[model samples]
Target: MMVANEDVQVAPTRGRPATLSADGIVDVALKLLDAHPKDELSMAKIARELSVSPPALYRYFPTRTSLLNAMSAAVFADFPEMPADRSWREQLLAWQNDVAAVYERHHGVMMLMGWDDQLAGPWLKVQMPVLTLLHSIGFSRLSLVETTSWFLAATVGLIRTYLAADSDGLSRSDLIEFSEGLGGLTDAQRMLVEETREWISRGDPARILNLGFEALVDGVERRLGSLQAKGHI
Candidate 1:
């Protein structure tokens, strides 16, 4: 199952053909997941799709969990890194854009984020620097742990808000329908959602990410000052 070009702006024009080996089995599984959810996928299904017996697959994956672990490791193994000298906000904006670009380029890879330990561990290791960067910049004004949590919510919140949006991003009209149908939003609340949606739709998704991330950092700056003044950092 190739990633549809329409779904991701960066989906590759072609894929490397896999030979029926350990890497090959994992590669095919990754492709197959583009169409099916994780729970619905199994080695037997993969074997059938590959026109090989299930036992033949054992030479590669050994077990389903191991295959997933391998997949997780592969996704993060060569993920990009930021340069050493940029300011914190610049580095973080780059970090957010980098992850978004990675997900767009690899297609279904981000879905593995919900998998168990094997998937979670390596993924976090790759992305942890973003959190550490925030902590380093915020310093005593914000506890590293709490600041990291807020950063996660802010970044992930922005990503999740429109990750499903396509190349053009979401439209104000789309959000209008949602706001109207999903009643109980006061006019002020509805207006806020509409404005946020419009801001997101203004350009490529990276623009929305930048705006949201900067707003988050600005809020952090404010809170940090308040905490310091109150002797609570």
Candidate 2:
């Protein structure tokens, strides 16, 4: 179930100034992330930046890991609401592109997405919409779960790779050239390099995400069809 916008409220802290809400803390953290890479942004640093005592920061975050988990949830919440009229593939691509943009804007959060604890809250909110899409497309319950899991993994993996590469300040063209220079390239490898260059030149994240997502969807659909033909669905 996609969380209703009303249900996504940050817990209100008592006795704090109106400006000292969790949302305000997340805003500060995002600014810090934009200024520093993931490994460099610390809870102490955020506290110092906000001019709050470290213990005061603990009143909200409790620990560095908890703070990071909150940050990850914030990232997911920042995604633009999906368009209702788009196809499932289109919706998924849009969602992935939105996530990629957020990761690009706050490169620090990319590192946290890999940790299971950090990802839990966002995953709960994410999987339902994806599962609903799969169900609408005629996927069985078990297959819907499996396929959505794979899609999330792939989308996050791609975003992680993209952010890590961006942090190094390597242009997309540079990455393509580097990939092409590797020895023993298979035809598929060359094609990927070419496609990557095109995607980069166009500055089209949607195209890149959609291409990868569509391939995954195609595989899932084919498998589902086969299973259904065998009376599995």
lDDT by residue (tens digit), candidate 2, 1-233:
11111222234335655556677787898777755563466556666677665555667767666766677787777567767799766787777777677766666655545453334567467556777777777776677777778877887777666446336442342344555475678889877867777656566654565676677667667877887899877
Error of 1 at 169 (Å): 13
Could you tell me the TM-score of candidate 1? 0.68
lDDT scores in order: 0.61, 0.64
- TM-score leader: 1
Per-residue lDDT over 1-233 for candidate 1, one digit per residue giving the tens place of the 0 to 100 score: 22111211222223333556777777777766644432356666776677666666655555656676777777678777876688776776777777666555454555555464333666788668866675666554436667667876676656655564222332222333454544787888888877777664456655656787788767667766776788775
Q: Tell me the number of clashing residue pairs for each predicted model.
A: 0, 0
- Candidate 2 lDDT at 142 equals 79
Residue pairs whose backbone atoms clash in candidate 2: none
Clashing pairs in 1: none
Q: How well does model 1 score by local distance difference test?
A: 0.61
With candidate 2 superimposed using the best TM-score fit, by how many Å does residue 80's alpha carbon deviate from the native?
3.5
